[model samples]
Target: MEDNDQRLQRIKKLETLRQLGVQPYGTRFEVKDRAGDLIRLHGRKSKETLEQERIECTLAGRIVALRRFGKAAFAVLQDGADRLQVYLKKDLLGEQTYRICEELDLGDWIGVTGRLFRTKTNEFTVEVRSLTFLSKALRPLPEKWHGLTDVETRYRQRYVDLIANPSVHEIFITRSRIIAAIRSFLIERGFLEVETPMMHPIPGGATAKPFVTHHNALGMDLYLRIAPELYLKRLIVGGFPRVFEINRNFRNEGISTIHNPEFTMLEFYVAFADYTDLMGLTEELFVRLGREVLGRTVIDYQGRQIDLTPPWRRWSYHQAILEVNKLDESVLRDRSSALAAAKQLGVEVDPNAPLAAVLNEMFEETVEPHLQQPTFITDYPIELSPLARRKDSDPTLTDRFELYIAGREIANAFSELNDPLDQRRRFEAQASQRVAGDEEAHLVDEDFLRALEYGMPPTAGEGIGIDRLVMLFTNQASIRDVVLFPQLKPEK
Candidate 1:
């Protein structure tokens, strides 16, 4: 009823405006000043100073607050960045302009010609000489609704949420700065930014189910890329020495505090660099971001002070599992023993599951939660890393490391597996797993394999989850808070 009344009131005013030979919806106005810039530049000027200068300016914004008296009134205008007070008096303006001001609504957009002055209370304000109605808002602002507290409405009606909660603007602005900084950092290091395909003929990058669609003309099924790893690596084979891509990846996955089906990633590859070299680069990148974004190496995330200083703690995959669970080497020596140890540790696993999958699950359950500070768990088992290079001393383990911060995996890096023969074997192994009910297993991309035969350089590649990184920097508790429009189910 309130909304309907607002619409009717606006219509009545539109007729009144037409009768007065006024354009309710106005055209071009030469806006000479912004509220924020004016406040910043001349806010300190005294009442006498403003009166002496007689500074004339034109401004435009939405009417967020208004107050009316017998023949005098005050209205607060909210511009793009800040708010300023505008005093409208009928006696100074005769009666026609004051009537136009009276016709104004809370959410209406207007342009005003005014002079700067200090209010009697010493507040900096714009004394309006004339008002031009620009646009009429049908519905009112979300004044009565608690915009931030209601998650469903907050995400659903983001426009209203933004107006009701002014601080929400900072979150998106900070996210933009983070991405721009990443691009600048990589570009300075001779990394060439490139674009990759979002649709793939076959999903071969990461082990995640894909969202598939069909191309009508081509008459073939295409998968929304779960990751751009494969296409980026193809750039390596094409002789691009250094490349980086920042884009969205889609996956058919369940929603959670840390997981979003569609999210952005920063993936980069460098030739002649191993996983160890990339680790040091990763530390430097975060430390640089820390000083640039927050002006310090320490950040408060979810009530914990996370220090991103260099030389973070490192642990081998097997070592972390053993120390966290206090298990003997013999306990995880073979499939049966590892299965028994898992059951004893209360980590459930399918009895028929491969030992590699069970052992990985054990690490996730027992060790990941304790990695609060910046830590790197390295040298994953061979079966778990199909695209990573094998370690020289222990071929059973691959040269890969996953960086964890605040008990969540923020980045994953590895030495690329450039040998076509070995990569083919690993792809076959994953295909077998897929046949046996593991839908999230990698598939053999013959084109990617053939590209491997063309010989890619020994390179190090890494993917950093941009969403989770933004969450930590912004002090947001959930992934939804960082994402502008996170995936959500329809209203029932």
Candidate 2:
């Protein structure tokens, strides 16, 4: 609901403008220069130099501030990322034009034809020769001192937040730059960017509860993809050696500072590459992104200086758990012992969970938060990784690694499991877990298995959470801070 007094005043102003034969809302105004460019080009010029040069410019922007003294007024106009001051005089604009200006309010969009000049305070300004109204704002902006301080309101009404806060604007700008850098890095490495389906008959790429929908015509249930991994792998089987997709993924999961149901991910695969090779590539990509985006190989994230230099520390899953908790090695080698240790450490675990799952729970609860620096936890238990190949030396562990930085997992990669019989066994295990009431277990994707039967080459694939990457680079604490429009409950 609008304040009646303010709305009445603006409506009266609109009617008055109509009576004077002026269209308060304009169609098109030719803008020859932007306010920022004008300031950048001539801001350093001396008053005398500007006066002698007599530079003329036409610019358009939203009126952000206004101050009036009878027939003279000063207003600040913001265009793009820059702001410029405008000086309006009743004598220069004539009585009719000055009256139109008097009706203007802050938040109105307008165009002005003016000459560059410097005020006595040495502030660059535009001396307006004429003005045209582009649009009107009936309601006033939020108070300047308080600003849009409510967190929920800021996320709900992002446009107002952008207008009230300049820092928010820069975060989104950096987000675009980060994505562009990723594309440039991949394209230069001969990776072909491709699109994959967002809806799938079965969600198999990742272990996550999926958002389900019904297809009316087919009378079958479909799931919004939790990852593009399955489709991208199918492409590899079809003979596209190197491919990548930067797209959205949907998961039916709890919401938190670090979790959003719908989010962006970057999934890439390379034939003839292994998990170790991807680790090196991941290091190069991170170093390049840090240097290009922040101009440094080390960045301050949430007050911790995280170095992006390559050769990040590598540790096995069990080794990382031991480093963090000092648990005896025997405790992790058997399900009953791991479950007992997990109970002693106050980490929750299912009574019937396998040894690998119990150890995983302990590691996630104890070790993940302490991984402040970039590190890789490699050689996961075979039960924990359904799609990764088993290591040659240790068949119980799979050739997989997860990159952790700033106390959170940023990337997960593994050598693809190409053996059809092995993949069938893994899928069967996952199906059993699903039937045993694990909603997050992967479904058996027969189509993916069929594709694998055609014989895919030895390959490696990785998925990176783009939102978390943006948070790391932008120094944001919450995933919502980086996502432009995060999921939120309806306002009461």
Candidate 3:
């Protein structure tokens, strides 16, 4: 039978109750106690003893299960903690209330004022003195044993999903705690939290395409921010020594199990600190949060134990990549030799690609998945880091690192570039890439360049993917699982 047809029949039955001088949809209900409290209070009492005491309490919940046996009826009502059985008998409730019980269906919201007692079957229950309908649910719940299983519908109708599966509610609850912990951790460390513009005339944070929108009145085009990196640096130039922002970042890119179109990102900048300090901070924060949130430093993410203890292993990006490809680190010094090594190791190398770009591609395809534990892969090639400060010992590399856990990049940090001249040169190089048809190349933000001319302090900055971190802490498999409203493909 059609679901709506069934709902219509229930609605008609509910209207009949109103016509018979009973309010089917009540305006207010004063619930004195919860179902769980009632059960706990009466579980130890003897049935005969409780029947003599007749403890009065009022409770309201959604009707989950109902069974009618002529004069007597039992209905399971679910409150927040758990469900409790409510017994209705014609002998006790009289014919008028018994008639109302016959019209009540599963999924309707109801209020029951009753005496706490134990049933003959050793079950704790509420023996009703009065019953009322708080709200009439026209539609029935999905089946008792089976639930809403369609993935698209689950995401679209999230409220129904929350009602069907209690675990989904816990996931989002943990997500909020994860973010709150991050903010608290940072604020406690003397970091000033700030907000930056979401729409920018030039998006220069990271290498990614941006969602473009036009301002009709102003006759100008703006891009949704890919990262808050560049603007946060501008704040540093304006003399905010320690700052961070927990905000939404939109990326016009592909979505996957680990990637979302719009996601939360935590960007922080520390003046005079380096990537090394930031690494220590990241490790300590995760370990502390693990102990605080889940009561353990060891988290099981997708069946792998991720230890967030201090002193996470640090390896240079090139070193890790070479080990994955079974090549010696010495081969990384020469471009031609590196290409030859890649070929010998069966790794694809684009001849025209920059050396760092080829190496990064190889690492992502080969080594990233093997970094299953908390580890920092540091010292990336200069070609891959336009905003990072060049290492003094080796100008060919940048003072940067990325934290990888469970095969995904969780955080990116670097000793930020503060020299205006060097910054301009880097932007010009990226502009050249743009001219060569690289759509993902960074744009030259003139204001950011102008801010750098004011002589910003030496600073270290990091951007952590908040959704991915929550997934790790919550033991969720996909980014969508942690995100309440993940972007999805529109139905045809």
Query: Highest TM-score among the candidates is held by which one?
Result: 2
Point out the higher-scoring one by TM-score: 2 or 3: 2
- Candidate 1's C-alpha runs over 4 A off are 22-25, 92-94, 145-148
Give the range of the ten consecutive residues with the poorest summed lDDT in model 1.
140-149
For candidate 2, the lDDT comes to 0.91
Per-residue lDDT of candidate 1, residues 52-148 (tens digit): 9998889998888889987988888888647889898887676988888778888788888889999889999988888788887777776564345
Query: What is the per-residue lDDT of model 3 for residues 1-492, given as tens digits with 9 covering 90 to 100?
Result: 778888899989888889878877789788899877777767788888888897888999988789999899999888863688999888998888788888888888889988888887978888888888788888878764226677776776676676676678778888888888988999999999999999989987899999999989989999999998888998888889999999899988998988999999999999999989899899888987898789999999888899888888899988888787788776676677777777776778787777777677778888898999888999998889999999999998999999999999999999998999999999999999999999889878889999999898989999999999999988888888888888999866
Best by lDDT: 2
Cα lDDT tens digits, model 2, 1-492, are: 455677788989988888877898889999999987887799999999999999999999888889999999999997865789999999999999999998888888899999999998988999999999898888777766126688987888887777777678788988998899999999999999999999899986899999999999999999999999989999999999999999999999999999999999999999999999999999999999998988999999988999999899998888989878887889867778888888999999989877777888899999999899999999998888999999999999999999999999999999989998899999998899899999998878889999999999999999999999999999999999999899999889
After aligning candidate 3 to the native by TM-score, how far in Å is the CA of 324 from where it should be? 2.1
Tell me model 1's lDDT, rounded to 2 decimals.
0.89
Worst 10 residues of 2 by lDDT: 139-148
Residue runs of model 3 more than 4 Å from their true location after superposition: 17-58, 80-82, 88-98, 144-147, 330-351
List the candidate numbers ranked by TM-score, top first: 2, 1, 3
